[model samples]
Target: MSALLSLRSVSVNFGRGEKALRVVDGVSFDIDVGGTLGLVGESGSGKSVTSLAVLRLIPERLGWSTRGRIEFEGQNLLDLPADKMPEIRGRDIAMIFQEPMSSLNPVMTIGSQISEALFLHGWPNRAKRHARVVEMLRLVGIPDPEGRLGAYPHQFSGGMRQRVMIAMALACSPKLLIADEATTALDVTIQAQVLELMKKIRSDTGTAILMISHDLGVIADICDRVVVMYSGRVVEVADIRSLLQRPAHPYTRGLLESVPRKGQERERLYQVPGSVPMAGSVRQGCPFRARCSVAVDKCAVKMPPMFRFAEDQRAACWVSAEQSNAPVIEDLK
Candidate 1:
């Protein structure tokens, strides 16, 4: 089976010459058909930038160049003509952004907003579009969608707006959905509902998802494969079960430990120590060396490679890979 999406050595750089900032560097991963791949990292880790790059949504006008392949269903989207993106973007691959209100048109009626995609995609006949919109609203658990059609975004609750966004994104039945922090703004109960909704959509439609967020719990709950990134590079990738049970990289473990567990009693939650470095701050060695508990002399001098630690797990840490019997890889310049 072909992968729904693939990112091969993808890097995103902004600005020109000495002012260039590599926001995403040498990152690679894939999502099999109907698979959920999570990109977990703190703020400025480039998770969101990676997602935008996948969608060709990055502001290249500000002087940016994305290096490497971004393949979707065997087509390198990076090479696809810009004018041809309409057939691919919402029709083949869609995205639900972080904030619902910001993504939605506040002045437009919910009904009109949802119907816009159907119309743009050549779904003529207002009656059929109305029916589809209502069906979509109902599918996403909206109450009396037909009656609520004319309501503006502010009228609905936060969760409701998110559901509306999901409905709009899935309305086209895109084969891939890039959900960038899809549930970060909702309350716990609503977040659970939205997460469950996304899972159901994947199961029902066979739509692959690239879930990006800093929430380990959310990643463990929804993703089949997880990618750990730090300061713009992919440091680890593993199956969700192995990642949650036996994380290979110190960064991955630090993230899991930092989250507040359900029944654990502690004076304070564990922290990874230090914040995510700003763009272009760390230019050598392992990006996490400054904070890694197991860092060695080599970690500060040579960049670590993604060494396979298990059949399906890989990490980019000198000490962790060495401990796992993964051969130390020299500078991969």
Candidate 2:
């Protein structure tokens, strides 16, 4: 399948001059048409920032600047005129933010919030917009959808609120959905329901999804491909099966081992030593070298380029590269 969304060497920086921080460093990946790709990493790994950069949502006044290419459906989003972005944001690409309560307007009825996107995207007929809102609510499994149209956001439960957010996002039938920690605030049951809802939406609409989360379990449940990031840079990319079976990057391995297993309730979960380094703190070499058990001298001298282990798998780790005997495909540094 062709790429629905492609990010090439995308970098996001905050502040300027000597004090500037490179929060998202030269990250590159692709989401195939109608495919699900998961961006998995810790909280400070720049997952959220990268998603925001794609939509040009970064606050320029706050000294945030984005570089590199973000291509969606053959158009480079970075090169698009600023005024043209709003035209594409909801119609072509929509985002489900982490917090539904904060994202949804408390004062406005759920119906109005869902209809807002449709109206902005040129669905000027009020009756049609209301119908679309009801349709979307029903599609997301909201019971008594027509009756709840007038309900405020606070009137709904957390899962219901998230479903409303999803309904609103999909109201315009966007080609790509960027869900950043979409299920993080929900309980396991609700998270599973939301994931299933997303899968159903994709199956029903053929919409490609970019699922961003720190939980590999969530990623495993929903993503076909996984991109493992560390300290703002992508360290590994592989099919979900390959990644779960044999993670190429140390960071990826660490993340998998840290997850609690079904029968390991009594066992202490393995932990990746040390927290993620502050953004831009690792000025040279592999950002994960300090915590990596297998770090070599080469890891300290310079960052390793992505080594192709297979057609669908790549890792930016010297040890993995050496062991696999794969040629360097791309230098991210």
Poorly placed runs, candidate 2 (over 4 Å): 331-333
**Per-residue C-alpha lDDT of model 1 across residues 1-333, encoded as one tens digit per residue:** 578788998999998778789889998888899899999999999999999998898988979889899999899999988887777878888899999768899899999988998887878889999999999999999999999999999999999999999999988888899999999988999999999999999888888998998998999899999999899999999999889899989999999999898899999999988888885578888889888898999998988888887777888888887777896433332
lDDT of 2 by residue, 103-140 (tens): 89989999999999999999999999999999999999
Q: Judge candidate 1 at residue 155 and give its lDDT.
A: 96
Model 1 scores a C-alpha lDDT of 0.89
TM-score for all models, in order of appearance: 0.96, 0.98
Maximum-TM-score candidate: 2
Total colliding residue pairs, candidate 1: 0
Report the error of model 1 at residue 34, Å.
Answer: 0.6
Q: What's the number of clashes in each of the models?
A: 0, 0
